[model samples]
Target: MSSPPLPLPHLALIGAGITSLTLSLRLTSLGIPHTIYEQSPSLTELGAGLGFGPNAARALEYIDPRLVEIFNQTATFVGTPSPQGKELLLQEGKAGDDKIWIEFLDGTKQPEEGEELKPEFVIRAGNNKGHAAVHRGAWLDVLGGLVDTRERVRFGKRVVDVVLPAGSKGRVKILLADGTEAEADGVVGCDGVKSKVRQVLMEALGEGREKGKCGYSGKYAYRCLVPWGKAVEAVGEDRAGVSSLWMGPNRHLLTFPVDKQDEKFLNLVAFVTDESQVWPERGPASLTLPATKADALGDFEQAGFSDSVLQLLKVTNEKMDKWGLYDVADRPLSKFYSGRIMVIGDAAHASTPHHGSGAGFCMEDIAVLGALFEEAIARQRLTVDALEDVFAAFDNQRRERDQWLVNSSRRAADLYQWRIPEFLKPNSLEKMKADIEQRQEFCWGFNVGAAVREAKKHMSERLAAYK
Candidate 1:
């Protein structure tokens, strides 16, 4: 008699963000069949700069080193913008309301002197040491293009709910927005912070209404982009080529460069930790709220930062949007799986952007998950009925590490805003520089390939228990 087909012959992915795409890459490599559902009409990314470290870059080797290649090709070193075009950028201000002055927290102005700081002053806030930066839109475009089965990605199909079939070997049924339904042997939630699949799973497990909800992390970011020529003219050439993180009490500002096509753009992000400030939208955990340049300027003035930073924001094109930093730590998940359903990436361990390792951590999940699936298929030991092993192995391997990131990012933010009492002394700046360097080592030291190997081993050990 012919052998029965594998249990997970078909899998369904909800959401087409980076996590979904990365998982698709791995499953396709193993010749696993799956389909991706995206609520967005098209694959597009908003926001400003994105980055990951050297260790996270290596994780791409598991899927395709070409991902790292695409990143390197499009990425601009933080702080470096084209100097030859600085004059033109300053002249071609988008709104024609460009301010020509800069101010600093040190009570001195740029192009004027007041306690000059070295370039390393940028990373003194305990940041990713090997960070490589890229435009959010550009990186998304590259990853979306690299999918071998683009046709498998379905757009405008929002997943509303998911339920497992009554029988053990039956498929998991997924309901979509248009009242249509799809079935798969397994389902993975890559739906990000506001995940519908996660909602379904949480509701099923009786985890309570508030157990898995995302909430504001008591911080908001004023994210904007300025033309290359203008940023150089405003911040000057020397400061333009080196990335800097200005950390003050309860606030921090960072600047980096994004290379898109032939033009280089400077990405400016200013984050504030204010309990009094509220997002314009009082509705549920919305992605972002509309913002104005004047709003950002007013916030900066209160932040007590230099006017030089304000000069760059003044010339940025379009209305600056203030993104409330909403993370999952409000209801942190102690477990990443339930039955055959699993939540990955932001849906599982959403973190603050303080470490700049969020994207990197998502990729690591894909690597380890792929490894587990690959091993099971090879052993012919994985079937829909054996999903206990899949869920157990993934959570056992990933739960603490990913959640640690959630907690670590919160701690890092506290340090950056000087909320931590240990970093509050007069000599605390120097102490922070030393202390954070060691603390940040784990952020860059994680090896995704090794992580996958370890997960695979745990999966086998767990599966054997059933026999």
Candidate 2:
């Protein structure tokens, strides 16, 4: 008699964001059959500047060094050591006075007469200290070029619903908005903040009705990218090249460099908390509304921001749009899996961008997922129950860290805006500095390797028990 046919593994990936693309790279490397379904007619990324912490870079390394290579090629580094070399990365005892990550300054008050303005504190590059940022759309374009072969990714296919299989060997049926259906062994939801897949899983698990929705964050930002030369002239070359954060009451502004095509640009985001009006409920469109340079300057007119910050804002287009920030903190998910379906990236644990590590943590999620799938396929555990085991293990390994990010990010925003009650008193700068240091280390020092190993071990145990 002929030998039994080898089991084939296939997965459906929802969304074409960085997380899904990174997972696609890993799955392709492992020879796993999968397809990416994107709701848009073509892959695109909004927002301006995006960065990776040390932990995120490490996660990419674990997934495949090539991902890091792509990152290096796309991202812009501040001080010495070009992106071609790895010297200015997250290293120990390598942080110098010149290798700065971000310089935090007070924007609420001007300096005293004859006193030069200085940073309240600086987070340098060392001891898991790295920050490399790029234009979101540019980075997405590069990653897309690598994974999207036209055949592997199907565009304009929105996942309306996912139907889980009743039996272990049966396929999960995915219903699309365009009146089509596809089947796969498993589905990974990477559909982002307003995820339809998350809603499906929430309903399936009988979770709260509000758990899947994104909360308005009570804040919004005016973002733009100015030409490098204009930024240098506006804020001086030092401020133009290095990442800096200006802190004030009810608002803050951050600036960093990003390359667009052959020209370097300074990406700026000015954040303001609106206590006067609640964010209006709107559909999942741009998440932005029209504003003018006058509107932006008016928001900060009374904040006592430095001349440089005002100049940076003035360089933006005459007409601009302010993006409303949103996250899942209002209703954090306690679970990430239901049946063979799982949520990753923003779909699972969307957080405010205050920490600047959302994408990094998402990369960490992809690393854990890739490792578990690798283990499952290696052990011939292609059945639905086995895949479910893989997802369960992933949840156990990732839930704490990812959810902690959602909460910590909110706190970070408060700290930047000087809204934290405890740190409001005089002589509290030291306390605030300590808090920032500890939090940064906690996120930058996460052990992706151990997480991967632990997740795979747990999946192996589950597969053994199932047998």
Candidate 3:
């Protein structure tokens, strides 16, 4: 029995960041032609470093096994803490059997070593080593280079509006900022946190308040990247691989390595409470200090922040990059697709960086999109109507997961905050471990290829109605 030929979709993907790049690679592998539009006149690395977990690493593995190999070789994975610190927090794995061990700064163990540690709990110190930290620009460059030049990732093309053809089953038209237009069978909106395509999708659903509403998490971040040589000289070489997190009243500071060089670059993130919810804001370059160098360190110095963090702050010639940390607090959207247009990544569900899953979630989006497109084309099921069903299924399978991440990240933010009560402190480590285990089951357990298969099954039933 001869199989029916697959339908070919002319796909248009907006944004060339990590998510878009991943999708571009996947589309290339499936021989599905696509055009990518990026708003930045030129593509450049925006942030310093990113921490990727097993879930994100697995998603990348599905995209290209070589990517995983490269990441493992070039990146640093911190799994076990050195004898330098005290143990304060613990995290357990999914079965509540495996435990992460940690020593906090004060040398106090919420769960002392040799005690019966459950797999469900996480030692805050132990969980620290479970992530692979890499430079943001370096990681993006790796993915961007993999994209074929023939695919034409067009820059300087900010999407202003999405034009649907007169009839429901018409070509998807994308309006560019420069007054030009491009047409395709469907559009994938990976346009990031402030997405224009999302606005169009919301309007189509007649959800006005949802489209206009923006999240305000009452948190802000200050980020700076410092050279490795300077960091090691200030913080010492032994502290290079370990990420130091100092928790204080209503604030915290995180410092970690981004590269593998002896004098590698270190990325610093300072999270503080700020009532304002604006984006693209700049933080103060310098704080008031007395004559002494210690005085100049201010609150950060008093908190026992590593010398590397202080050095980065002192040497930063420009104001640190500051932005509001916002997440969608409302329930997840019921729909993520309309007509030939669909939303992916942060555009669909923005979340806090507490769990370091922003890029991970985006990668997951790309993997799922690639798989669905492959099946639809293979089954000869690709069409305007067919794509709608595929998009709906993609939304159906993904919305709940994305929303879960959003809520989980919010909870993590609360747990990591500096002001936890004393009584709560003893149980925090055990609870933290348990939370990690649950997170692994929910997040790391996701299978993009399987999800696509399920989506395909659902899409097939829907497509039969139109036949």
Candidate 4:
């Protein structure tokens, strides 16, 4: 007799952000049927600068190698450092010599690079390699286009509730805002930090509400896009590519380029401490500061920030468009899965942007989830019990990596928050150079693809044993 037909996996993904979009594409490639319910009526590009690291770039490659090529065509790589470009400042070593260095807490050293490495206050700056800064919108457009409309990515369908049915092999039901409901073999919540599915899981598990909280990062950010011509007139045309980071007491400023076809826009971001933990509910046009331009600029002016950085803030015509920066911690969740429901991306862990790894982490989630599902289907083990096992394994594999990234990102923030102090700071520029050199491996050495493959191997063994 002929073998029974293989069961098809039906996935319901909530939210249509980059994480959801990438997951949709991966599901399609694996031939796993799925549907997406995006709350937004239409996908619009939001946010400012996005720094895609090598790991994130690799994830993009897995989805579509052409994405990398398309990104490179419009984006310029930051290479050499210029006076008009971005700068990193360091102080002289304890030896009181003309050279400066970065002293690590672990007793490592990094030397200064160029003539800017003066003894009094050294500035050893170089271009950030293997990293590309692009407009948020441009990146979204590439990922969004990957979604096949025929695959059923429904827009304007807000997920109101997730109903977990009792008993084995029962389907999970997703209630929508339009008084409609859809049942699926499984549901993936990529709905971001404020995830309704997460709420349901927490309540069902008796975890109680307010158990996990998301708060502002004690920082307010001012972001704007300035025309290249306007920026050049202020900072000089030669300073276009470098991502300048200016550090001061309790505040910082970052500027980078976002290239389009014929025009290049300068993305400027300034962060300062705010007493309130709530983010701005409006945009830049609604922000009103009692402080003058000088006060708002603060110590950034003393750090020799470019005129263009100051100009962008001054020229902003509206305050409502300005947004505040907020972040969530690595909160303990009761679980990542319940019955036929699971969560991924920011819905699982919403971290601070200090390390620029939010998008990277989310992409990693998609890769891991996709790999597990692929193996289950290949083995003809696509039942509710099999999926639950997959979810458990996926979470176990990801927990450590996510926590490490979160801690590392927080440490990076502390390092960049202050200038080199006398006596306590590095003694020589060569010594400072050595300190930074030691950290190179740790910063760029992550391999998400390898981790995913390994996790799948381990998980497949566990699933077989359980069977």
- Give all candidates' CA lDDT scores: 0.71, 0.81, 0.64, 0.61
| Candidate 4 segments whose C-alpha is farther than 4 A from its true place | 1-5, 80-129, 278-312, 315-320, 330-334, 419-443
Pairs with steric clashes in candidate 2: none
Runs in model 3 deviating more than 4 A are 1-7, 80-130, 209-213, 260-263, 276-318, 419-429, 445-466
- Measured with C-alpha atoms, the lDDT of residue 375 in candidate 2 is 82
Report lDDT (Cα) of residue 436, candidate 4: 39
By TM-score rank, best first, the candidates go 2, 1, 3, 4
Location of the lowest summed lDDT over 10 successive residues in candidate 1: 94-103
Candidate 1, residues 137-181: lDDT per residue as tens digits? 878878788885457788989887899766566789999989999
lDDT of 3 by residue, 1-467 (tens): 97666556788988887787888888778777789999887566665888775567666766766676677666655542322211111112222222232212221112344442122222432332245677788777788777774356899899988877778777899999899999999999888766777777887777853552346677766776767676666556645445655444455666777773443677777766653434443332122111322332564665555444465457443455455676675535558888788889887888878767788888777667766766677667776667777788788778888878888877665655544464256556666556645664565456555665676676666666657
Residue-level lDDT of model 4, residues 225-300, one tens digit each, is: 7777776665555444455554444556566677765667777666665546565545422332333345456434
TM-score of candidate 2 to 2 decimals: 0.93
Model 2 C-alpha lDDT per residue in residues 1-467, reported as the tens digit of each score: 96563565688999999889988988888778899999999988875778777788778887878777777776776543454235445343344324677889887656675565578888765543667777799878877888854978899999888998776668899999999999988999999988888888887789844567777888888888888888888767877878889999989999888887788888888999887546765665457888898888988877777765787788887887887888888787778988889899999998889888999999999889888888887777755557778888889989899999999998898899988899999999988888887888788778788888887788788888886
Position 422, candidate 1: lDDT: 73
lDDT of 1: 0.71
| TM-score of every candidate | 0.87, 0.93, 0.79, 0.79
